[model samples]
Target: MRKTCLDMVYELAKADDRIVFIGSDLGAGTLSEMQKNMPERFFMEGVSEANIIGMAAGLAMDGFIPYVNTISTFITRRCYEQIAIDLCLHNLPVKLIANGGGLVYAPLGPTHLAIEDIAIMRSLPNMNIVSPSDAEEMKRFMNQSKEIKGPVYIRLAKGGDEIVSDPKNGFKFGESILIKDVGEVLIVSSGITTKEAIYASEELSKEGIKAGVLHMHTIKPFDYKSIIKYSQKVKLIVSVEEHIKNNGLGSAIGDVLNDNCYHKMPKLIKLGIPDQFPDKYGTQEDLLKYYSLDSKSIYESVLGFIKSKGLKAA
Candidate 1:
């Protein structure tokens, strides 16, 4: 996903000189061609991440579409005030290319982990959040970023997942994809967690549980209507993500259920990491297994949760 995003953005920069790229000390090897080609438009600000956003804001004010790239924690958490006051205040079209989103940096410890970035960015007024499931969605979202006139956060991941979305699928900015049979068990997820949900759905099919997977690429301005419709039909709704449960996708869907007046709604289960720092070092896959976010654990947990609720499978 990261390579696809950079490839498309570099292509956009070639035809138009107005596209400026800014990086806060990252991906030096991959961006060598871009830096050599467009030296004037590319800026390599040192470790000062806050200043990078400010510079991007200034460049945007001067008729440049500045795209900032950095680690997830540094981009949102470190320079939030700058984003709010400098960029979002003017509604600048600054594309945020954030890598290592969620718990992708499990071995680096909690400081490098961005478990709450989605929740933090969703609170900003004019921020547009896009969590693409794979490389195909990343390319589509990059094309859509050109049309949007405000701050946009584009979440990226390491590639090599199944292509759940086709290139011919109608692409929109703030839409959701319902990927399988619309049954009584609906699984809503974003980012790489979408892949985990897909695996769990396939496992559930073996038990005669027709699980539905909704890949929510967009977080802010969520498609509440679709969420409520799925919630009504499903006997159980499970939200899976790599982010913290609080203020993440799960909480957002819960709010939609409340507003739509679905008092007797299906049981909603939030699956993700708990609210605590990690004590030991491990790989991303190990952390997932420890958190019970792998395919087998997720499938078993969903079945157990549903059975405990005394709900019949659809």
Candidate 2:
């Protein structure tokens, strides 16, 4: 997914002279073609995340659309003030291509993990948050990202995720994609968690249960209409994300449910990382299992919720 995003940046730069690429302490060969071809537009900065946000802001002020790339934690946590003041406050046309979103860096421990990135970015005004499910979706998103007028936080998972996104569904920024129609339960998910939710929905189907999957690739400017539409038909709504439980995808959906579905709100279960830092070190998949965010765990949790609520297939 990260490669697709950077490659698309390079591709977009070829046609649009206003587009520029900035990398922070990345490898020498990260975007070799772009650096070799467009030397003036390609910038490889040091480990200064804060400075890069300011630099991108300046470039945006000068009518250049800068695309800054770096690890998610450093970009969001280390340079939050700059991001908020420089790009978001000005509503510049800068794109923040964040790598290693969620637990992709689980082996490196808490300092590197980006479990709260979504929540942090969502808080900033005029900042758009996008989490593509796979490489193909990233391509579709990057194609349209240039048209958005404000700053965008592109959350990228580790590469080689399952390609569950279909072009037939159509790609629109800030619009939720309904992978499966609403049934007895609706699984609202973003980023790679959508894959697990799809698997869980399939597993539930075999046991005489009907489940649906709604992929919210764009977090901010959420699709509240979709939640209200699906909530009316389902007995339960499950929001699954790779970030922490508070102020993340689930919380965004919860706000929508509270505001619009007051009379006919369905049961909502938020499945995500806990509030504390991880106590152990492992790969991304290992950490996902430890946090009970895997497919089997999601399936079991949904089934248990249904049984406890006495919800039958509709």
> CA lDDT, every prediction?
0.84, 0.93
lDDT of 1 by residue, 1-314 (tens): 88888787788899888898888878767677888988998787899989999899988899899888888888989999998888878889999999888877888998988888998998888988889888888888888777788989887766565566767665688888887766879889888778888899998988778899998998977989889888878888889878888888999998998788467688788888788876555877787788777777779878997688776665
| Tens digits of lDDT, candidate 2, 31-116 | 99999999999999999999999999999999999999999999999999999999999999999999999999888999999999
Please report the TM-score between candidate 1 and the true structure: 0.95
TM-score of 2: 0.98
> Which sections of candidate 1 miss by over 4 Å?
159-162
Residue-pair clashes per candidate: 0, 0
TM-score of each: 0.95, 0.98
Q: Per-residue lDDT for 178 in model 2?
A: 92
Clashing pairs in 1: none
Worst 10 residues of 1 by lDDT: 157-166
Q: How accurate locally is residue 195 in candidate 1, as Cα lDDT from 0 to 100? A: 83
